[model samples]
Target: MKNMKISRRKMLIRSACLTIGSLFIPISYATAVNGNRHLSKGLDLIHKVLSRPLDVSISHLNKCLSSGKIDLENHEGFKDYINSLITVFNGHHHGEDEILFPTFEEKIKGADFSKLKKQHKEIHPIAEKIKDKINVTDPSFDNYEEIRNLLQKMNDLWIEHRDEEEGIVELDMEPLISSKEQIELNDKLSKHGRDMSEPANLILPFLIYNLEGSDRDTFTDDMPWILKNFVVPIIWKSKWEKMKPFLLA
Candidate 1:
């Protein structure tokens, strides 16, 4: 009877310890243990996918403007390189503006992304301006100051918007949505983006090559087998070779 009483007391103590220990666990970590992957985990990859190319492009362009790499090298792969960066950036927001945002508004209760949508409205035009300039400008000729200044503006706007979106995903959306739902919605979002603004040669290499380490493995593992095997290696790699100086991979 005494041993039975001690066993009950130990169980109660263990229960109390678990309850108190849980108080120290982060809400997101606990949620992950509960089987809901944080929305930010997936979205962060997309954000990097969308932003890194532009960042590298901006960096290259700045170096060119400073040291006149623009006037040298016969333009080579530079123009196409910049285009690929901008295309991925544009394609992502296009998905968000056209599909993702609307879907979220419909599915998620109290999900008012009207401000985020407004940000897209503002962002796209600047992107378009840059696109227009890219269409005309090259390493040999064009106004570097205008391109530089516009990129600065876009960078400022994008950094703020990216943080805002990530915050919403982490704080508001993650609790409300599950890992499964985010994956499903991301599929819809990606399909829309592919339909809108992509050529595999530019988009795939730019995306896959820019990524590294675990992100590259995870993202590549998710890609269609044909792309992972044939299209990228046999067909597309040589095409982007001129841009090697700018590529991360």
Candidate 2:
């Protein structure tokens, strides 16, 4: 994580003034700092921000919706979450298409960049439709079927696309790139996500809540000291109070 560009010290300094919201009431759910689940480890420098975070999001979303948890009480928070999820997913791909893929196309010999690009093209409309549906649909006993279907479709497409992409990245791409190069790529991609997160409150909570076990450790460990240590416990609930009801962690 040496080259993760947003150094902990820098982030701490940048984020210091944002603690005004820290005084609000904290959430009741116990912190997941000592997480229960195990993370599939690769290189945390990349996968922590890219692969596993998205994977956690997809799985949690599927589980929450499929387990019959969607309801009127959570309708607003859930909608907020869907938007945040899409923002992160869309931003990641934007970074890839704009920054990462071009690098891979130039660097990795015979890389089938088109296949991934094609899948992205297919997934975009589905995600866009999901957002539209989520925004309009109020959950009732029978009204949410289409939203569920769209979410499932979105999750499935993402699963298929990301699995294929991760294999290529870890096997074909990792060997060709230097550690420094990987960090540079990770930083740019992370910046893109940071730039895209709206309502900012939801982004950090989304990231922390989605991660678990050693994966959580790696993310928190790498976070600027102020964010993971102070913001999460003291500031998170106040900032994300609206979405807390529907959040997984």
Task: Point to the candidate with the largest lDDT.
Answer: 1
Best by TM-score: 1
Tell me how far the alpha carbon of residue 205 in candidate 1 is from the true structure, in angstroms, after superposition: 0.3
Which pairs clash (backbone N, Cα, C closer than 3 Å) in model 1?
Answer: none
TM per prediction: 0.77, 0.71
Write one digit per residue (lDDT tens) for candidate 1, span 76-150. 566667677677676677767776677677888889898888887887788778776766534343565567778
Task: Evaluate all candidate structures by whole-model CA lDDT and list the values in order.
Answer: 0.65, 0.59
Model 1 clashing-pair count: 0
Cα error, residue 238 of model 1, in Å, equals 2.1
TM-score of candidate 2 versus the correct structure, residues matched by position? 0.71
**Model 2 residue 28 lDDT score:** 11
Candidate 2 lDDT, 89-141, residue by residue in tens? 67657767887789878887787689989998998898788677778655543
